[model samples]
Target: MHKQRLVIAGSGSTYTMGMMMSLIEEKENFPLKEVVFYDIDEQRQERNAKATEILFKERYPELESFSYTTNKEIAFKDADFVFVQIRTGGLPMREKDEQISLKHGVVGQETCGPGGMAYGLRSIKDMIELVNDIRTYAPHAWILNYTNPAAIVAVALKQEFPDDHRLLNICDMPIAIMISYAKMLNIDVWEIVPEYFGLNHFGWFTKIYDKSGNDHTERLKSRIIDEGFTPEDTEIANDVSWQKTFEQARQMLMDFPEYLPNTYLQYYLYPDQMVEKEDPERTRARQVIEGRQNRVHSLCDGIIEKGTAKDADLHVDIHGVFMVKAAASLAYNLNERFIVITENNGIISNLPEDAMVEVPALLTANGPKPFAIGEIPTFYKGLIEGQYAYEKLVTEAYFENSYQKLVQALTLNRTVISPDKAKAILEDMMEANASYWPELN
Candidate 1:
């Protein structure tokens, strides 16, 4: 077999960088011939690049490693697979994302709301560059993107470059949430059979079963209701589930009859709109960025600060073991249904076929095979349609300059921000993320 090439975008992110570092602990890494770190900023990638090289040399000497410039041809040359976890902008802009949302009174966070849409805009250009690079240098390479606003990014990519087949978009939320569930049931996440669907941070828990055909969701829900969360559960949430699930669960249980929803938005941001007059920290994003973010990013930073380049080889999957198994299942999964993003194609009864909806699907080497969604409750239809509109608008904004599209994204977000406040926050984000998102300006 030929050697495998993995190109990891967003090498600067501590989690992405840490995941690379953890690769050393992997079992000989599946015949990796080379690994490439691609980032727009040299300063950002250098730390991770040097750290990884040191780790690889010390722990996995046989594995080859190289860091690439953002140059498309040079970076993507002959890649076999691409692992992309781009933020487009760095943490500082993320702070602005949350702050802006709070001014409008919507819960503010990195990848939800007008702020998330803002983050989405800043990222599209860089993502487009990566997409274009694949077309140029590694057309056959499979691109597994774990970028925020996964739905938005995926929609933009599929719309702009309709011909690309090597694209697979994913969010770590579902996998991470499953891990949270697995611990409650005293099993590894991979051992659990689950059915779930929704857009990235905005999805649902449809079904869950264990090796013995046990529906564990009710069990998991009861445990969490009683116990709140465990060490492992909190670890995954603080580190990588984004801020969506945990924060949302408490209210979901209180506000509706639905299963306590996932954490995609629970702990994210709770304000409706952002305003300069309010205490900056009062905004959910600011509270997170100023107060909670370091708690999260520091996990990876600690590993980097403590380790030499040689230590990079030992980076372990501290909170992401679930993904390893999910990835594995694509090749040999026992036909389990997963909530994956796929074209509706009438797979979701009553939903538009051309639209991408999250629904139960079979995972195989052939790709995600979505099953029928059957009839949804009327309430769900309206909610889903609203979210669908947001995704479409964001995707449209990327493809063309339509203020109308941006409006739709905000209206559906419905985090309790007034339309006027939403527009204000949107404008602030457009200005703050100006460098990262040229099209919006």
Candidate 2:
């Protein structure tokens, strides 16, 4: 059992604390020789780094070194797995992303519509740069990305590093949704075997079979429609916005009962409803800042002030655990099944071969071997093609720095079907993201 050296790329995030906590909890399964925190924002990372140091000292005083750094060479060098979760412009820009989209009567989400396109443009620059550095330094290291607007970032990375199977793109939403499904069925999450397909955040669960090999999809759908749905987690379950999201999931299932749709589909399927529920004065970014961000930072402040993590109240959530599980599946060849983002390559037979699609795959040492989802129906194919085009256009717009391409992408997006509205949102987003995005001419 060779212990791995892990590097968390975006250590400044509120999620880092949970990830560190998760690492400590899962140490026996995915043992580490070292753990390093790497982030560009020194001030933000310092708080998390200091708190993590305290937690590690008391909880994980194990094999070897633990450190945090801003230097890529120091962080990436000799690492076995790099968990990438960088937020390019951070929450302030995310607030702008939401507010800007809302100003134009579109879905104001972090990773959908015009807002996602803005965030996608910013993420490509940083993710590509990070991948290039990983190649230069830890050439053999596996890159597990948990970045938002994953559909766009995945496409961009595939275009640049087509053969880099070590770079795995994953999302936690499907896992979280499954948790809710298990709760509905009164069973453990692992007992449910899910068959899912689509792009990241924009997908659906085609089938869910229990350990007994019994199809529970229709049963779960009836439960959701009858009783509504909520995330099984305490923190997310209590969120007002998330509550509405689940409610919308129920509504979606009632309207289109063939398959259970991902909660995020609400934004595209009913943009007006999503927009109506939002408070333009305080978007999801602001909610995160006030909620999780403040909670984690405050915990850090407490840990630092006491100089001990004995009383630290950091809660490990599925987001962090899922990332570690993905890495472990690769490290130990567990062949664990997960819904991950991978090149379509005919996984969805009707979709473009090059389009990056989300589907269940067995994560092994070689990489994720995606299951074949032979052709889909006309309704799903039409929706997926349109969304895929939007995602591809966003990636192309970033690489070419073409404002026209971005406009085309937004126009194609379901949330903003009007070319004029797309132009309006793009112009606002361009000005808001001027500091982060490449100059689009």
Candidate 3:
């Protein structure tokens, strides 16, 4: 059993401690020889480092090593796996992304519409830099990127690092959905297998079957149509915003009625409704800043004040666990099936070969081997094509620094259809993200 060296690139993120907790729980399966936390912010990372140190000492004092650093070389050096979850401009810029879009009367979400495009533009440069650093220091390290705007990020990475099979773009939303389905079916999540396809946030569950080959798609759809996506015991269901997003699946089912929709589709399928529902002053970023951000910081402060995390109630985030599990699968050659974002390459017969699509894949020590999802219906094909065009153009814009391409990308978004609105939103985003995004002319 080879003990691995794990590096968390965005160690200051609110989710880092939860990932550490997950590593603690799965120590026996995925032994860690060393764990390094890397973040650019000194103050914030130190708080996380303090809490993690306390937890590691109290929980697993004999663990080989645990440390945090701002040095990219120190963090990535000799690392076996790099967990990348970076936010380029953090919450402040995210809030700007949302508010700017809302001012223009479009849906302003972190990972959808104009807001997502803005985020994508800022993220590409950072993501590329991280990848380059990882390759330089730890060429063999597996990079499991859980970054937002995953669809766009994946597309850009594919273009940038076409030959790097070690890089895997993943999102926990599908796993979160499966957890809900498991709760509804009264079975452990591991007992079920799902067949799904689409770009990141805009995918659907075509089939779900148990180990015994019992198809549960219709049964799940029936429940979703009647009562909405009510997962009895899950972290995502606890939040009011998330609850609304989940429940909106019922309406999507009413309209599409062919497959179970991802919660994020609410942004695209009901862009007008989403805009109407949003409060410009108090966007989702504000809620997270007030809720998860504050809570995590407070918990860290408490751990630091008490000098122990023995009694501190920390959330065991399933999202973090999912990423850790994927890493473990790769390390141990478990060949577990997971939904990840990868290039189509004929995986979806109807979509362009170059487009990145999310589909179920078998994870092994090698990399993801995506399962084939044959040609989709006309309606889904059209929707995906439009979104893929926007994603491709955004990636191109970032690399080419073409303001025209950026405008074209925003214009294709479901949330901002008009060229004038797209231009206004792009210019506002450019001004707000001046420090982060590259000069586009």
- lDDT by residue (tens digit), candidate 1, 80-185: 7677887766666777777666666666666667767887887777788778877688877777777877777877877877776557776656666676678778
- Identify the runs in model 1 with alpha carbons over 4 angstroms from their true place: 66-68, 230-248, 265-279, 282-315, 318-339, 438-441
Clashing pairs in 2: none
What's the lDDT for residue 265 in model 1?
A: 40
TM-score of each: 0.84, 0.98, 0.98
- State which candidate has the highest lDDT: 2
For model 2, give the 10-residue run with minimal summed lDDT.
226-235
Q: What is the lDDT of residue 255 in candidate 2?
A: 94
User: On residues 76-164, what C-alpha lDDT tens digit does candidate 2 reach at each position?
Assistant: 99889999999999999899999998989989989999889989999999999999998899999999999988999999999999989
Q: Considering only N, C-alpha and C atoms within 3 Å, which residue pairs clash in candidate 3?
A: none
Which 10-residue window in model 1 sums to the lowest lDDT? 267-276
Q: For residues 1-441, could you state the per-residue lDDT of candidate 3 as single tens digits?
A: 899999999889998888888888788878888999998988889999999999999887768899999998999988999999999999988999999999999998999998899899889999999999999999999999999899999999999999999999999888888888998888988788999999999999999999899999999888877766764434556788888887887889889989888889999999999999999899999999998899889999999999989889876667777888889999999998899998899999989999999999999998998899999999999999999999999999989989999889888988898999999988888889888888888
The order of the candidates by lDDT, greatest first, is: 2, 3, 1
